[model samples]
Target: MLSTYVDLAVGLVLAFLFLSLLVSGINEGLVRLLSIRSKFLWAFLRDTLDGPDRQGRSFLPAGMRDVFTALPFSRDARPRHNSMPSPAVLSPIPEGEAVAEGELTERLYERVREIDHPKAKRTSIATLPPERFALALMEFASAEPNGVQGLLDKLKAMRSPLHGHLQGIWESSAADVNRFRQQVEVWFDAEMRRLTLLYRRYVRWVVAVLGLVLTLVFSMDALEYGKTLLRDQAFREGVAAIAGGGDQGLTALKDRCTATGDSADPYRCVTEALSSPALVKIFDHALVGVAVPQNGDPQVKWNLGAWWERLISPGHWPGFVLTFAALLFGASFWWDILRRLTGIRSRAGR
Candidate 1:
């Protein structure tokens, strides 16, 4: 009993220690993989862009006034000069109004060059009206062979206008680049969050499984100990005492006399009857048939057998039940703790 108890205590302690170590390891791994500087930086960028502070801000230049002047006009705003000739329409066309397609391209190219220059102003083309520049570029693309590429080359060669329009394009392109970068950051943050959640959940599952394994191991050990205790000679003796002394009581009470035939005295006949083989066989068969019969008084043999059957055999069932319950509870508790640690709850809800 002493050895069994000691073994059980040691096993319990070991199980606890193992569980603690497992949990600690899982937490450390999670932190290493998910908690890093890059993740924080991306998160910061995402939050900054999503905030309302930078809205309606223009990062564009000066001296580019005429470039954006006619941009706000709707596409249909152009006068139909040839639709209906009238006496009122005899006014001479302004030189600026009759500018050729090629001249417009050259002017646009010069403006782009001015905007791109290092000393160019920082103003937004979008703020001035994007339609004019868009329309001009579109008209230039239609009239030129190399599209925007041809226009870019011409703008690069120009000395005047100082790449101002190109600078505007660069600013516009920068905004696009920034916006794209922000999107990438947001996506990265979201993916990290997702992976972190998944890892946490996985850790929880591992903990639960580990705990269950520990419980089963502990319970089995306990059950084996209990079985050993039940089978111990000293324990059996105690149980036997409680069940009452067997066979000897019955033998002491019965007389060895009384026979139906061939006896000189009743005592002798009783003695012979007591020693009869047929009678012994009958009693042995009767004992075997009954579950727990009370025949006059309990004998030592009967007491021992009853004790073994009633006390020892039934103890195994309760032990098994307790062990199974312990394992189940351990598994459940481990799973809950793991879930909280990993941030899996939020992910599950989403």
Candidate 2:
């Protein structure tokens, strides 16, 4: 009995330690996986918006400009130009250049004012500024059938350096984006693989722990069965009777015979002893009871039924409470591990 108690205590301690380690491993794995995924996502977004220039001077639409500015990239270092270059260099007509440039500037300013102040009383010209309207006319002229193909052929032949620069910028940006996306994918795959391995390890640990617990429980039961066999009365008596019944079996039996109170024959005494309630209780209690009392006489009749009743009585509520507490603790620990594993799987899937 003392050994059984010691084994139970050791088993409980080992199980607790095993479960704690399992839970800690699962939590650590999930946390690392999540951290990797977060870093990957942030890096992907940063690469997408910042481009390969890294100087934050990439041309973008107004809305896209706002988005890029919101990212972590540094602002453009060059100052923005608000006006066109001087006209003297644009045209070298000494006599009429000043008057022509002044009239052109005045007309352009007036046209911009008209476009900005359009109303029901405003002049019509598609409500567009003069520069925009002129650009649209130029685009239409460029698309005309008369010389559009010829002009395009000539422009292609020229192969402007600005076009090559823009193309190179675009290609480099695309390659960087592709590289960033690939890196993100690789990171994600690695994290998922790590998490999967962790999950498998956790499952294996749970299985091992469960197997250990079951083995312990069954071993305790087997030990209890062995103890009962050692303390059984009928088994001991059978062995003793077998050893002593060699030659005087019939005479010994006749000498031990007596008149029964319930029946008439002396041989009925043996049958009465066999049918005694005390003998029945001994067998019942030894097989199914909690504790076998170590009385002075090893062959004395044991009250196996009363022992069972005492062990399983409702009055032993403390045992039930302890069992319930252990179950609750185990359940909570299992639930925490399960939740952590599920979260890791879900995140990896994402």
> What's the distance in Å from true for residue 145, model 1?
20
lDDT of 1 by residue, 34-125 (tens): 33222232222222222111353221111123112221221111111222222321221113335332333233333333223232121111
Model 1 poorest ten-residue lDDT run: 71-80
Model 1, global lDDT: 0.36
Which runs of model 1 end up more than 4 angstroms from their true locations? 1-18, 22-175, 220-350
lDDT of 2 by residue, 136-187 (tens): 2224224445332332232233332222332343354463533433443444
Q: How good is model 2 by TM-score?
A: 0.17
Model 1: how far residue 83 lies from native, Å? 73
How many residue pairs clash per model? Answer: 30, 1
Tell me the TM-score of each prediction against the true structure. Answer: 0.21, 0.17
Off by over 4 Å in 2: 1-175, 220-350
**Each candidate: what lDDT?**
0.36, 0.35
